[model samples]
Target: MVQPNPPVLEVSGLSMHFTSGRGKKKTTLKAVDQVSFSIGHAETFGLVGESGCGKTTCGRTIIRLYNPTAGKIMVKGRDLSGKLNKEERRFLTDNVAMIFQDPIESLNPRMTIEEIVGEGLTVKGKMNRAEVRRRVYETLDKVGLTQEHATRYPHEFSGGQRQRVGIARALINQPSLIIADEPVSALDVSIQAQVINLLNDLKRDLGLSILFIAHDLSVVKYFSDKIGVMYFGKMVELAEGEELYKNPMHPYTRSLLSAVPRPNPLTERFRVRVNYDPEAEHDYTSEQPRMAQLSPGHFVWCSPSEQQRYESMMRQ
Candidate 1:
């Protein structure tokens, strides 16, 4: 059998920390701690966790929005670490783009939708005025927005429509990797499905790779091929979406799945409650936690005792 190609984006030992104060009073907050994962070409990889668990930070760091304090971020075999020449930075920008959660805030209120979508092309000097307009119109049509809507301000559109504009802007660059950070979290339940379907359609139509970050496991399960569960500042579980949902490895993952509201009332009644003390502080002063492969294509981070207990439980 022929082996598969390597992933389009590979992140290894990625870590991000924030240092505050000075002298003996200096303190460090590990926003993203030793995370590693890969996204195949055209794959939808989902990262799910609570609000403050560093999901957004990880996504931002991968795109170089936040310069990672440590580790490697490889895009199509090129490591984005050292300062790149002007042209190289431009190339990276064109290859990877992000779609933020709030479309209203993400889109400049001053700019028309056409200008917003065409901004990337304008910056890259990729096309003249006529060509830019033509391309922008085409992209708008692709995202289910009319050419007329292009002239309207972001505030004029509904939440879903504005998000479509955001998607259009990201897609206009024709990026290989699009990091969608909680793209549907803000939309109404009815509109959320529409946006999710639109994203799925775009992935198929454009042959795009997406790193979808969200806190909802059900949505992530529907959109992702593989899922990585984050807790605090670490990835506690990584596995195929279906497998992870059926058999969660980490305690955190299990707790999350247990809380998913099932459609069946009977099953929903049996849902387990996960308790985490928000007021309690975590002690991270010891040796750094390391992730270990628990099975083929599945990984988890746990103490030696916890790992042994997990293994014994699985064997039972």
Candidate 2:
């Protein structure tokens, strides 16, 4: 029998918690709880949820920005859940790069585009000025920026152009996985499409795997091969992009889908939004719900009875 290939990135039972205050006054926030999923080589895995739903926290935790409270994070089948040596830390940093949300905030106001894009190369060490300049120019060109733009600072560029700089910076390192946290959210609607198209082209050209994190379901549907819907800190539903959009089993997932505005006038006029309240949606006081495989490559968090209901709904 042949063994299956491991995912480029896999996360299992991952959790990140934060405590504020001191002593009894301290409050513990479960920023991310038991999140699990994987991204295949060259695949785009979209994570969608509302603000404060732990989507960004989960992405940051995967890239080792914060120490996980529990669970495992595997990069190309190599476990990164444990403490790492300096060498391991450098390796991880080189392999996983992040594209932050706000372009202006992410880029240094004082640094020119060349310095911003080539910073990763500098951190990796031993590159002379000319070598760093060459890679920076090459990466900038790839992201639709010219050599002229490289001489300018972040404040000199428009929001869209600033984001292009961010992309250039992420691509300069040639990372295996990119954690893009709401990359286009702050841009104008027209600029959003341009940036999205640029990312799609780059992904295809680079054969890159991305963990695309955003609150917009429509954008995620356009970008992801697989989609994971997060609520609070838990992933309530996981499925292929089309499957989840067509038949969302979890109540929270359904509620989220219903809220996305449609272009059709009649449909938009008649659509009723679904409001999901966890307390009203589930009876977790008695039988607990575990993540269940509802179908091939589809998973949902539900009790046995709820699972049966979902199965029956699919049948209908």
* Candidate maximizing lDDT: 2
Candidate 1 residue-wise lDDT, 1-316, digit = tens: 2136667789998999989999999999999988999999899999999888999999998878788988888887777865667776787787899999998899999999999999999987858999999999999999899999988998899999999999999988889999999999999999999999999999998889999999988899999999999988889899999878777767778778777777898767876687544234222345334687766777878655556666676666
Which candidate leads the pack in TM-score?
2
Per-candidate TM equals 0.93, 0.97
Clashing pairs in 1: none
Give candidates' CA RMSD values in order: 3.1, 1.7
Residue 3's lDDT in candidate 2: 28
Q: Write the per-residue lDDT of candidate 2 for residues 220-296, one digit (tens) a residue.
A: 99999999999999999999999999889999999999999978997899999999898888998888888999999
Stretches of model 2 off by over 4 angstroms after superposition:
1-4
